[model samples]
Target: MNPTQKMSLQAIDLVGPSQPLVSLIINNYNYAAFLAEAIDSCLNQTYPRIEVIVVDDGSQDGSPQIIESYGAKIIPVLKANGGQASAMNSGFSVSAGEIVIFLDADDYLIPNAVETIVARWQPETAQLHYRLTVVNTEGEAVGFCPSPGVQLATGTVWPILLKRGRYHSNVTSGNAFSRSALDKVLPIPETDFRIAADGYLVGAVPFWGSVAAIEEPLGCYRQHSSNAWSNSQSTEDPQKLVKRLRWALKHDLHRYYWIQHQAKALGHPTQENLGLRDYMHLIDRLASLRLDPEQHPFASDASAGIARKGIGAVWQQDCLSTGRKLALLGWFAIAGFMPSLFATPTIEWFLLPTSRPQFIQKTIRGIKSLRVA
Candidate 1:
């Protein structure tokens, strides 16, 4: 049964009594200024059975105090600074709800966002999935954005999922899933890496069970100066972006290897996870580097045979490998991973018009030429 059917059944049980439960997990860090707005957005949800969890990863800033201002209504889990993944993990650790949703500290939720999303969640199953509505700082419909295994293009998720693959390579954090679906994929690895944990998690979920999608803007995406992957990311040093990409790759590789091992240990199939060839590939790549086994984190005997394939497996599956893939990967490794170097060209390429006037005339002519036949 889907969320609507489940809600309908529940409504029948209630005989016009009460509402279903929804747990909203907010992963907060140091954004004290924007914290209240994020929290308030949830508080104002049209759905009344919503429980809010604000996990604070030791903000030296006064974010903790801001959360405290909410008193008991907003459950606040305070902890030492543990990157975003750890903070998110902590948030889920304490959530008690049929479904789970994430609201970042810097972003606010649209009014009735929770109600809209929960309406689509299927309470009859252990898992639920849905598409999200992406909005800018102003509440207007700007365009679609990407999330793990989910992307928004004029309010559609199917095209991106089918074309891009199960894991959303671009964005994934602000999506909704059944708590049961989450428990199976919980405790996102506590890596020192600062990005891409959400992407890795999305990739891992398909193996768990029936994943689903819905077309609606479930929340508001705040685009501002302090967001981790902000609009200004294009202006950053190319080296920093490259470093971030490499780290993301490493983290994803680690998850793939681990999932592969878990599958083999349970005597299940390995196609969904890593394979023997995948482990071998990792070994050969490390050998090519000739790094001292004692010095590198990936050199341990335990980690050695994790995946046996070379770059072939990774590159083959990576869809982002357009013509520019190699050069971009090169930037990540050789050119200090500069984001600007890659972005400037991309921006210019997209902005350039072959012949603006001609294109406009053709477009107008085509529209005018449309006929009933």
Candidate 2:
């Protein structure tokens, strides 16, 4: 570790009872290979008043043995086979801290993660969303930030969510939830969120109050074979790409339904059509329609239909620059009007990150800070 990091860790190690009791929960399954590393990162946290919980959703592998070996160093829950949402529900049931962070078993945190998170937490904050650095199997940062550089304006942004259908957010490990807000939001719909439970949390929590943003990488999100979604076109086999788009469709609509549910419970207006106003989902719909029209879920959705709805969404997008809107509009017009053979690569180039040249990723990051001006 560098001197700067060492000194920072030393500073947080001395934190006292004045700090809120933060609970770091690691939800695991068949990730025995990465389980121990995840546990150590939490147990070794510099922030003093904290509890670490690991909920293993019945891994037939050696995961149980690893959890057993941890003994009292961590709280262990080895239950019958359930999905990600089930594991989170189990972890949240036993967690006793004011601030609860659900860390994926494959991800590890910086020593001061809890300290940094709690400092940003406010009385009305429903959840804290932070950025994460992508790491390889060898655990080195690959210079990628998963957050899409959109910040929901502070305070209740549910109106923004209803209008846009969703906000830019990160994966499971990059968020921390306020326990009180989660009490009203969680017990995540097990059937709907069987795999990506984070989607549910990110959408539902913002309804009760405000959401906070931390613009730094507090942890390392590891990409391995089991859940590896790549960005490179070379690795993008057509079958796999189609499968991913189908799943994205299901995942996007699932979150939208819950967002609608949250808005209605609070007596807020909701869109009449499912995800019709969502910008990113429209891109996915356009691609799916071109790639596999027969199996496409939206019967009435033609490329032009998606483009028209998406153009309106582009104008309604939060935290976007005019340059970005123009680029999106041009791409939509091209993809919507072009032949399938040409349109497929056109959309894939913009849709897949690895398909992007290194300079384009850098350009996206460079323009990440630009606003309406």
Candidate 3:
């Protein structure tokens, strides 16, 4: 037997037979170079009851051949070039396990990852969010993404999820979902979100049931040039940066709009989640500000309304600290009054207080380097 297979067998021998079955669905496109490592990671997990499935989204690379090499070890589903959402839906349609993890082709699990996840899962838990170590393309560990900072005091977390945006404290590869939760959320709405399908699921699942969390790093998230988020960070050109910012702003606005729609459909109180209401109002105000007050008659009054009620509402909430509420108000005021300010790196510094100073400094250095060249 090959070394990987033998190691997997050894690990399986250590796991108890009574463990619940977990499905690891690896979604891939052209990431052939990293595919095997991801699959091997799943195969080598200490948890014995796992079914590995690879869904190939019409990759032109040798990913199909690499998947074929696994043979009977993993189930392979090949389909036409659909986006990540489509691949996810295709994978979920065939999964039979009680727990499911949508593993990215570029990310892989730690040795005892699955075991840790299963151990922490409760019958009432709809999803479990675990920590993940961040790595570069070379597979060297960089840092870790932590679990949600706000403690979930109750069984239902829809209120907290709406208060904090969907992307906050969430890593797609670091989550495991109960089959029942997946049943409620899926088949994923591919048309609404062709990419970032996890964002949709993360936003929706909390409403269905409870969520648990594990702070220990259980997987590795590789950031590279090909990753969508990484691509925006790797550039320093002013025009490109501005374009990326606009795209991100619009994307976030779209996500918030979708969330608002979904929450209404699910009969959740969108008003009680002051953060959501504030964000929606802020986005609307910004959109209005982009046009002339004469052209958009409501622009001036709406912006003023948000600055009062929307910002005031969030500031009154107990969930956010004084500093966070101040920051939120500042962000909305600046973005509403001077939307062009975001075109510069200043917006990054304003919104992300932790890392944006370094980002802004790096961006300035890159601009200087271009001038020198």
Candidate 4:
């Protein structure tokens, strides 16, 4: 045999088993508009050893048809409307890959996404995270979201999760989790996670092992008003902003309650809980207080208390840029010291992208692009 051919065969043998199969699970619920693109992205991943599983959560639209159209190219899970968590549980039960990724139907991965995650895989890692480009309903780039800081929060991040109840991690589509990590926390409580199912997983997975980060965009996260989780929508209505803050508050609380249980089970109980110390949550609290003081949830939550805690949060935030910190600091001050009537409008301006002047939105989007760059 030729020496080169023999060496190649020997190298193959030394490299051990075939590449691990990656299960790309796409969860859909009335996202038929974008379902096909999401499935195509998974099927077309650069990684050769991968399986695409599409879970339709009783989508009434064309989602089932799209899934059917994929034929044998993908595995299909059709079930009654059970929300995001149920769909996730259903999908993973049938999956057989060493690496697993849950891609949202409204999102699509770049060709190299799975290939890159597989290349970066480590035996000790529980999960790997990457950034995502924010896009509109029409698939147009609308903005970018940076990691919570200059560098992603990685490695033994349970302590961060314990104190702050959050870390630098992206939504569902931006993460590829080890099967070992997922096994520990699967069957996510359906009712608790009907929306933002990724939040529970993101918090629970890091406790099992070290986490990793890719630090660049791997997919597109489409945002629109009709989204199940309407974060970063382009709506300008004042009442809608108030309603969103309330929804965010509830979601954050659910995340904390669930993660706390996961942590205690692992013997990593939090000595001091900083769950409410989150800057964004505080912003939500402060804004809610101003917008509708009568219905504000926290009884002891005064504007001053929120501002003080928010200042501390912003100061210690490892994920945000200095400019962002400064802006938040100024916001807290206004919300704390200014009259409610004045601060309410200002808060809405910051919270709603459509409320801002076009130039300002363009400028902010431009600045955020540098973070991903």
Best by lDDT: 4
**What residue runs in model 1 are displaced by over 4 Å at the alpha carbon?**
1-19, 123-142, 147-173, 192-194, 258-268, 271-373
Q: Where does model 3 exceed 4 Å of error?
A: 1-17, 146-155, 162-167, 249-266, 269-345, 348-373
Deviation (Å) of 328 in candidate 1: 13
Q: Tell me the TM-score of each prediction against the true structure.
A: 0.63, 0.88, 0.74, 0.92
Candidate 3 vs candidate 4, lDDT winner: 4
After best superposition, candidate 2 residue 122: deviation in angstroms? 0.9
Of candidate 4, the 10-residue stretch with the lowest lDDT total is 364-373
In order, the Cα lDDT scores of the candidates are: 0.55, 0.82, 0.71, 0.84
Residues 273-367, candidate 2: write the lDDT tens digits.
65788888888888888878999998988898898888888877756655566667766887888887778777777776557668766765565
lDDT (Cα, tens digit) per residue for candidate 1, span 1-373: 8999999998787853345577887888788878888889889998878899998888889998898899988888999887877877888888887777766777777777777766665544333344445555555654445432223222233222222233432244356667776777677777733444565455444445544554555556666656655542433353444333344345646756545543454465545433223422343333222222343334343322332233343344443323223432322232122344543433222222222356544653454344323
Please say which candidate is ahead in TM-score: 2 or 3: 2
Query: Which residue pairs in candidate 4 have backbone atoms (N, alpha carbon, C) closer than 3 angstroms, thus clashing?
Result: 148-319, 149-319
TM-score of 1: 0.63
**Candidate 3, residues 166-272: lDDT per residue as tens digits?**
43345679888899988977877777667777877777777667878777788999888788766665665434444554555455555666566668878876644
Off by over 4 Å in 2: 1-16, 147-153, 228-234, 321-327, 353-373
Question: Where's the lowest-lDDT run of ten residues in candidate 1?
Answer: 347-356
Candidate 3 has what TM-score? Answer: 0.74
Instruction: Evaluate model 4: give its TM-score.
Output: 0.92
